[model samples]
Target: MTKLVKPVIDQVWLLRWWHRHQAQRLNREADAIRNGLLQDLFAVRRQLELLPGSGGLAAVEHLYQALDALGNRLSSPYLHDSLPLAIQQALADWPPQVPTRAELPSHWPAEPVEHTLLLLAVLNHLGQALAAQPSLPQVCAVSLTAGSDGQRLTIAANYASAVPPALLELDQSEAWRAYLATFDLFSQGRASSAHGATTLRWAFVW
Candidate 1:
């Protein structure tokens, strides 16, 4: 009987290879879904828009509005060269009840597309989580700062009663970290809550 042995580097190399393949596959699928599917949906929407008035014209208009909203959500958001403006656009649709305050700098350079997208996703997810909570926070403060090494986003919320459990769970989820790793963007997030107040902060380095 004999046993086979391999260096630890072999395992590391294999993991890296597997991850690379997975990333490539994900990118391909995302591209196909975004471009191919969206194009078809838009074509249908255009046809619906051109239809003459009929018994279902009202229904058709409603369908068109639904399709338009879907298209807006599915399509990529444009990022302006002014990072502050881009961030503001991303937060424009945030929940009004919570009263968010964004402290974004006016002059920072535009971030990488991946960075921009990830920021949007995180913010949107947070907004959804907050909206689902029965008790809304008094205020939600979001601040973006650029240091010599990197940039940071700090989100703090003050709830007059208690911090929502869902927010804590979402903060601990691995999805955000996985997204960062997939995009090869270094990021760190910290969450803390006490006395009906909570803060989550994420910093990114290029």
Candidate 2:
């Protein structure tokens, strides 16, 4: 009876040790995952800060040239007579075959040429990002909503399925960095993702 009792006690002790070991290992793994997530978040924020908005002065120069050309055309009596045509010609061209579609205001408020160009760059980059991920759903949806006073812009991208890994990887790529730099003026912005969608919300004094 004494010998049998010793074996039973040993077995219980071994089981308890194994359980504790597994719990510790799981805790370590959870901590590692949390640390990794925090690191990625900080990295993204740093990248955003370093990116040159609108390609810095060079992009500004190009925008000015475009505005100048448009101004010259508008100065002409024939072109000035047709304001709508002039405005349409001055605006940026939309891309072809983007799976994601944008819902913008019926009439975008008049903004400075530089601001318009920046907005166009953001849209172009978003389209390119979606195009790069073939695994994305056939019909992704993008919507841009402006505040009542036009002081803010909310850009949302909703996916029919989970966002592809490749698309998420773009956040660390050089091309994405360059594209983000063009939004330097929009420093006060926040981005978030959940439930197969991502949203960028930006606020400006304007």
Candidate 3:
């Protein structure tokens, strides 16, 4: 394997907007990204028009400049980084596609243990944040309420602030590992033994 480029701390997916500037480059390379190119362009144009004229326009313009800089620095998510340039070109334009039974790629990414843990940590962090705002209504946890009660809560079991039950069983959570497994990496890799809703709010970065 080539040396893994250390990931930039701040990462953002550009979604369909990036292609507008590279429409021809994308169409010539990744048809999957280009398959519905015209439609996506229209959608982005619509969004730009909807941009508010006051502070929002300036904020969004600045956002584009920042993303352009990030794109120059970071090409893609770490998981997709290792693909051959040919594949990278293909993925650059990967919009959703309909697949014939035989067309699906034999290899695809399954949610790995680490990624799952990270997602859990994020959910846990969000849950805690929502939990703090009583006006937002109680966002309960599946591991807490079994996700069956129709309590009209704001969040889904797909994401919550509690450490996911699936991740809580790791053999020896080295602090942050446990928290990240719950979807809240607020402390990055430092909040080793935190508990309750404040896990992220008071995370120790040491």
TM-score of each: 0.56, 0.42, 0.18
How many Å off is the CA of 118 in candidate 3?
1.4
| Candidate that beats the other on TM-score, 1 or 3, i.e. the better one | 1
For model 1, what is the C-alpha lDDT against the true structure?
Answer: 0.59
Residue 21 in candidate 2 has what lDDT? 58
The 10-residue segment with the lowest total lDDT in model 3: 95-104
lDDT tens digits by residue: candidate 2, 1-206: 45544445565456545644553454344444445543554455456557777245454445545544443332321121332232333222323444444444455444433343344445556656665566644554444456665344444444545556666666557765654553442332433333345432222223
TM-score for candidate 3, residues paired by index = 0.18
Residues 110-153, candidate 1, lDDT per residue (tens digit)? 66444455566667776776777777777887888877756666
Best by TM-score: 1
* Residue ranges of candidate 3 with Cα displaced over 4 Å: 1-110, 136-206
Candidate 1 matches the true fold with a TM-score of: 0.56
Q: For each predicted model, how many residue pairs clash, with residues at least 3 apart or on different chains?
A: 0, 5, 13
Give me the overall lDDT of model 2: 0.45
